[model samples]
Target: MDEETFNISMRKFLKKVGVTSQQEIEKAIRAGLANGRLKGDEKLPAKMVLTIGGVDLTFAV
Candidate 1:
């Protein structure tokens, strides 16, 4: 595989994931607040799981 091509693709994928995830999270937070499910000062727990072929990783954010 070409290293430059692989790096570019990986960066694009990560950027898309980051932007979309942020938008969804913001929308969820707004909905929760509107419905009295979440207050404005709560520490929220978030997790992310990534799987690629035989590799799996989990991260807590």
Candidate 2:
């Protein structure tokens, strides 16, 4: 694939990993919500990643 194609493919792969799509990320940002940028919608056990301060932030919420 070309450079552009590779970049797009990589972006999709990352999104599949953690729902890391541009729109969703942007929505989260606009809502002033940020827990862990790495953790996506439902790729893993959400509860496994405990809170650092005092917030039970789910992957979607």
Number of the top candidate by lDDT? Answer: 1
Task: Please give, for residues 1-61, the per-residue lDDT of candidate 2 as tens digits.
Answer: 5999999997886667566455665676655435555444544332223233467544433
Clashes of 1: 0
| Candidate 1: worst-modelled 10 consecutive residues by lDDT | 52-61
Evaluate model 1: give its lDDT.
Answer: 0.88
Those runs of model 2 whose alpha carbons end farther than 4 Å from true positions after fitting are 20-61
**TM-score (all chains, Cα) for each model:** 0.83, 0.30
Residue 31 lDDT in candidate 2? 56
TM-score leader: 1
